[model samples]
Target: MGDERGMTRMLLECSLSDKLCVVREQQYEVIIVPTLLVGIFLILLGVILWLFIRGQRGQDRRPAVRGTAPTPPSRALSGEGAGHGENVCVPLKETSVESFLRATTPDLAKLQVPREQISEDLEKIHNGSCGAIYRAKLNTGDPAKSKSVVLKTLKEPAGLQEVQDFLGRIQFYQHLGKHRNLVQLEGCCTERLPLYMVLEDVAQGDLLSFLWTCRRDVMTMDGLLYDLTEKQVYHIGKQVLLALEFLQEKHLFHGDVAARNIVIQSDLTAKLCGLGLAYEIHARGAISPTRAVPLKWLAPERLLLRPAGIKGDVYGAPPYPEVPPTSILQHLQRGKTMKRPSSCTQTMYSIMKSCWRWNEDNRPSPRELYLRLEAAAKTADDKAVLQVPELVVPELYAAVAGITVESLSYNYSVL
Candidate 1:
């Protein structure tokens, strides 16, 4: 009886100790378990917050304009373009020659050119780079009914390569068709001797002709076509800039942009013509330096014969306009005859300098040049007219180039 009582008492004490241990474990579990979970959640939340903040900052610095052909990453691709630019990449559609050609210009096969005999007669009247440029006969050669038309007769050795070049020009015009400052391509011809690249003829003629015949110092005061006012040049530049903007937006480059290629309409608007050298950007990741290029108005990188690209116009020599950006005017001030116009605007010169840089990395594209010109023109509030002699004045164009002002000795027959 005593042994049983002892055993029961021992059992009671052991059970009480076990209950105490259980109570301690429940308290610890409630406190430490909740703390561990909260710590883990806080760490996760901090990580998520960091990611969100970084993403927002990236979006802020990105370029607002889309469709800008992406260039290759420089070491400096640290910005939005390089960093978190576009996460959802769009696949580039493969473009064929036929598809690209069809998309850009009118059907080349349909247009008709003038005969060689007629072209030869016009060639007798005028001859230059590609031989003669003639005033085409109406209804006979021209399809687009307009005031006047000039048929560019491509001479013999106008082989398949020449035909390809002609096709290229038409393609460029077709895509860049119908801007107020862009010349219209009436049609083309391959039929009946002498291949022709026919286009709308501006009665007022080209900017070169206008400047030659109009400015007071360039021409006789009485023979001035339009005063050599800053306003006029500004207007010309403004119109040209607009067309350039359009071209740049389309990622097309006008390889030959000079006074001769600019046609002035009766309404004083300037149109861009002769797009035989325009190129399109196919690669989007970056512009490679292995592309074919022309040298004359090309940027330095292009002159080095590197791959040609958009904004390469910046590297080209200055055009005829007496703007800043080129050293041509400065060279003229030094009394020297440069191969090309280098001065138009300081910004323009810089842009061209960048465009014509020996290294493709250094050159700017035509689109960049267009933007620079537009911004520069916008900030220029000074509309003050600088004094320049009339078109009749002797040596008026000495201040500029590509001008030969003279008195009208005979009636200008528009016919």
Candidate 2:
């Protein structure tokens, strides 16, 4: 009876110990599960708060413009003052040709021409310092629609400088865009060797050649047979003035503006060519040392190695008017006093004289020149001007260079 009581007491004691261990495990689970869940919730809340704050910061960074779309971050801010100030926010020294092209011509892919489409055996029309210009036929999808184009290639053994110049010219055209008075860039082939820049073929060639031809004979166009009239001179002058006005608005100037640099179409339209000088001005914010600026065409300030500005372009107009060729030589020899052309009307003479003014401040702006030319064109009579014989004595041109007119054709290639 005593042994049975002892065994029953031991069993009850063991059962009580088991119940205590189970209660302890349950209590530990309840506390640990709630602590873990709270930690997870706090982590999630922190992530959400961080994301919301980041979004608010981004929104605050971009201020909206009134009555306009938000300004792009890349656009350059205008300069505060004029007179060779940093007019554009672009870094002049660091602006690579590739970056400039990408920024200005984002859709340049469409302007790329296939190498196979251009003819290999095209005739060279002109040879320039950069390279030779060839007349090529671009094969379009339709045989009849295939058109003639001018291909300007980099010279043989082209080095780093040549490549940079080629790319710079391409960048300039991209910035210039399309205009009626400017030579249109059709396409470019830069992927392959001997990179080519395709341009529209101006059929009648450059104005210098056209003027030479006209001086030799009374050229006929559109059923009108006549010499170059003062009215026609005004017409050409007006077109050039229009181009200059366009360039001025873009903060550019045609550094070399003369008949040789102007391309004449058979339709009597004059388009400006010779962008090499213009490119130099664009890149360096002044003339490049490599450029050989014709002294006769340059203003007195430019000839004296002074800084060139918009006023320098005004000096380019005197050579185009019907002045005696020797007059330029005489004017340069005499020092500062240039005689007005006797053939030109008093109004036209006054304009040319004003362009040659010793004081640049007195010179008219391109816009003013355009207006004056427009007025001259409206009031002038073509019939009386046509009666005067076209006078371009080859001997006079030959005297300066010690070459014949025929030889000048090969020697002189505009800019």
Estimated TM-score per prediction? Answer: 0.48, 0.66
Each model's lDDT comes to 0.51, 0.67
List residue ranges in candidate 1 displaced over 4 A: 1-131, 140-146, 157-168, 216-219, 279-296, 319-415
- For candidate 2, lDDT tens digit of each residue in 235-310? 9888888888788878887877877778888878999888776777788777678667555677767766777766
**In TM-score terms, which candidate is top?**
2
lDDT of 2 at 217: 52
Query: lDDT by residue for model 1 over 55-76, one digit each (tens)?
Result: 9998776533212233222211
Model 2 TM-score relative to the real fold: 0.66
- Candidate 2 stretches with Cα past 4 Å from truth are 1-107, 219-227, 316-342, 385-398, 401-415
Clashes of each: 56, 0
Global local distance difference test of model 1? 0.51
